[model samples]
Structures are given as C-alpha cells and as structure tokens.
Target: MRLSGERLVEYGEKGGCFVKKMTADDIKDIRELRELLEVGALKILFSKNNKQTIKELELICEDFTSMVEKGYYGGACEADVKFHEKIIEATGNERLLQIYHNSNIPLFHLKLGNALSHMDDYKQTDVEHRRIVDYLKNGKLKESIDTLLEHLDRGEKESIEF
Candidate 1:
C-alpha cells in the first residue's frame, strides 16, 4: 500500500508499521543506498530533456535558500526533500522513483532536520544547492555529480553526529 504524505510524516515523527529507530548499521546502509540511487538518478537526469524539471528545481532551491535565510529550518528541510524528490522524478525511471518512495523518506527527513538544527551557518548548503542547479542547468554532468556527492557526504556526516 502506498502511504499518503500525512501518513509518512506520522511515521517519521511517531514511528509506525514501516518505521523504526535506525541503528548505526541501518544508517550506513541507508546512506549507501541513497548515494547509489542519487547517482543513477543524476545520470538519467543528465540524459533527459528536462527544462521544466530544471526550472522547478531552481524555484525550489530559491525557496530553500529563503527559508534558511529566515531561520526557518523546518521549512528549509521540507524544501530540501522536495528538491531531491524532484530530481528523482526527473530521472524518468519508474523503478528508481518507486525505490525512493518506498525508502523511508520521512525518517531521512527527520535525520536531516536534526542535523540542520545543529548547524549555525546554512550558507554552505545554499551555495552547494545552487551549484548543483547551475551545473545541471549548464549540462556540466561531472561537476553536478561531484557537487551532489559532496553534499550527500556532508549530510551523512551531520546525520551521524546527531
């Protein structure tokens, strides 16, 4: 059965049938799987004609940046999830999208929120996200991939510390 967005949020906040507190190993596995999926999604995104998707991504990035600037960490995290989910959708790969949807997105968001709450300077995040958008928009595949990797790496480290 598919989960509604509200249900997913419930799972993330309160735990449910498909949600549980992640162990260190589970976190590691999730990180690895996320990296693999994102890399594949990026490759697919690069090959596709996605002008609309790029525009949407740009808007989301701007929204996220604004949220960060206003000290709205929760809003920023929501925008962050939407940005990544949009990338996954832009891949135009049904299986990849399904995998990401089934993966515990709410839990990932919770971890991300925790990490972001601990950070004082969100400028790095804003810059990196903008760079990813620029790289993708300009067809710089390698640079986009590298920036995405670095962003994910930093996220993983922050999550682990939380």
Candidate 2:
C-alpha cells in the first residue's frame, strides 16, 4: 500500500512541530558553541602543515577585507562564515563537521552582521584575520590558536553587546 499525499499532509498537520523564539540563554549557548567549535578547529588545523589550507585562508581573508571595504557588511559576515568554515573543514573530522552544522550558524551570522554594521574599525577585523593566517602560515601552532581564540572572544563580546 502507498501513502497518499493528502494523507501524509493530514498526518503532518496532526503531528505538531513548532519553532521557538531564541532566549537569552540560547544566545549565550550559541556564542559558547561557536567559541568551542572555532577554537577546536583552529587547534586541529594548526596541528597540520598544509600550505594549500593556508592559501585558501588567505583568499578568504582577502575576500572579507574587500567586502568590508565596499560596505557590504552582510557579505562580510558571509565571508567571515566561509573563513571559519574553511578552518573547520581543514580539521578533517566528520564529527566536528556535524557539530558545526548543527549549531545555529545563520543566527550567529545575523548577529555578527549587526555588530559589524556598528563597528568603526572594520579594518581591524581584517588585520586580526590576517594575523591568524600569518601565524598558521609560519607554522606557529600555539600562536595561531591563541590568536584564533582571541578573535573569537572579541566576536563574542561584540555580538553580546549588540
């Protein structure tokens, strides 16, 4: 027996599913999740010696800088996502990818976009991102991880204040 579309629609209608509004605690949790994911990804990427990864990160950093320069703050936020996503991909861990995917990244991007819109020195962000790439390129794992965490921390603070 095959299920009809109308029956499936009726079944779905009867089975309740709802989207909840994000609470303050939820926002805090997302921020912490982002920190953990980004820091862990950076640690993993730092452990590897991949010149190609560094080059990709450099390209993403340049794209972010260009986006900010053009006042495309939303595009800048997307570039920021791509920057971190590349780091996460470099880790080469499937579970980490799953965790990153499960997080509320779109909402995080929205908050980041809003924060970037209010910032006076967007170039400072580009500099921080470039510093991270520089550290990774130079094979400075400890410095790279430290810089990455600091960058994430600043983002968290800005998102919270926004």
- What are the Cα lDDT values of the candidates? 0.77, 0.74
The TM-score obtained by model 2 is 0.78
Q: Per-residue alpha-carbon lDDT of model 1 for 6-74, expressed as tens digits? A: 343224446555634556666677778878998888888889958898899999989988888888888
Per-prediction backbone clash count: 0, 0
- Estimate, for each residue in 1-162, the C-alpha lDDT of model 2 and write its tens digit: 122321211234667533344455655676678778888888888778778999999999989888888889888888878888898899999999877876656555565565567545367678788999998888887787778777766766665665
lDDT measured at residue 59 in model 2 versus the true structure, 0 to 100: 94
Off by over 4 Å in 2: 1-24, 119-121
Error (Å) of candidate 1 at residue 75 is 0.7
TM-score of each: 0.81, 0.78
The numbered model that scores best in TM-score is 1
Error of 2 at 42 (Å): 1.7
Query: Which residue pairs show backbone clashes in model 2?
Result: none
Off by over 4 Å in 1: 1-19, 119-121
